[model samples]
Target: MYDVDTRKRALALVAQGRSLNSVSKEMGISRHAITNWLSRLEPLPRTPPCVRCLESPGIPEDTAAYAYLLGLYLGDGYIISKPKQHYLMITCTASWPGLVDAAEEAMRKVLPWPSVNRLQRAGCVDVKSYTRHWVCLLPQHGPGKKHERPIALEPWQQAIVDAHPWEFIRGLIHSDGCRITNWTTRMVAGERKRYEYPRYLFSNKSDDIRKLFTDALDTVGVEWSTLARGSDPFNISVARKASVALMDAHVGPKY
Candidate 1:
């Protein structure tokens, strides 16, 4: 009878693209025995159980990725959970391909078991990951739009956001925020001078989501304020010089 070690060696050789005959000859095992071992090899796991749904029900191991994903979801992410369809989608602008890649990567890091793909829209790319567990991971899934409903984080999710504030902020900025430089010219000592104002702006129609962003900014000691162009006070501006510097250091542009 072949021992476990021998069986493992033969299987390893076969896994490395070696033919059954070659493995049998190299390991001094019969072809029938090798075939039997291969057949008995347990099927690889299809999809791992959601860590947040287990009996113990713990937070995701990659809290940083989870936090970032949470921010992206709050900003421009969508979840469709139904009897026939389920997935998590994050919309990224086609102009910034890097954000699309980052969104896909964050989804993978948070839930590596599912399949992630990019769908190109008219002017944007949708990074989608298929899994019903997304609803479990993000309880904010509901029937209405994000701004139309109450979006709040659970205790565990809040803990992750608090722990990785920068990652979370980065995700939000990458999804719905922008670092823009507005400039003006002024006559200084009879010479035309250019003054550049570089700042970060996070815009969302949901009041709760804007509050969450401000709360995270507060946690990170980044001063921010609200801006209203006409009547919609849906803009959070991190235009303070110090705060802008801090944002540049951590969350910079969405490239």
Candidate 2:
């Protein structure tokens, strides 16, 4: 059992905006313990007002985080906003604990007052934040599958994406993209030598969403091409050495 001082320090770190996962790792304390401490001391409260609902509605203060979340939402995330239920859910693979933590942290940064939780499934974890104002922030939430509908960013969101292109790219990569290396053996003089080609691939069936991703790539000067299998163009690939370098510096591989 942790002492009073330990609990205080953990809460203090959380108050300073550190994530529960990070705090738990640092203090060697389980997140359940820290959560129990918070629940005992903090009172149940109403959900906080969304910034977009203010008299003078404005974009989220942390535009970079918002842009990143937007990319993730468009990639594989979704929002549910029934009368009694409202939340944003981003699914991260269970294997990537760091990515799951990062997803929850981004949710908190974009909307600090929401209650964020994780739902673990067979091979993935859904990082969800409960709030009714998700619709206010993510206007793209709609009734059908994302691929069947038009996906266009509002001017304000576009501005944010333009400003923080790398974060947006990182979120997209983390959600629906991957970095891989392909190697082939070739004859060098009399010996067979192996060479590796590293590339980044983003696969999505939605035309509009793919356009948005490629447009962002264009803005960031990352050379990419549509990779086709047989007759279907279904993936975007960054195979050029310089473009791969740029993507590595910005997005890297998911944890």
lDDT of each: 0.86, 0.87
* Deviating ranges (above 4 Å) for candidate 1: 1-46, 185-187, 190-192
TM-score of each: 0.80, 0.81
Using TM-score as the measure, the top candidate is 2
For model 2, the superposed segments whose C-alpha errors exceed 4 Å read: 1-45, 190-192
Q: Please list the Cα RMSD from the true structure of every candidate, rounded to 1 decimal place.
A: 9.5, 7.1
TM-score, cand. 1: 0.80
For model 1, where is the 10-residue window of minimal lDDT?
A: 13-22
Cα-based RMSD of candidate 2? 7.1
Mind giving the per-residue lDDT tens digits that candidate 1 earns over 42-82? 63333467887799899888999999999999989998776
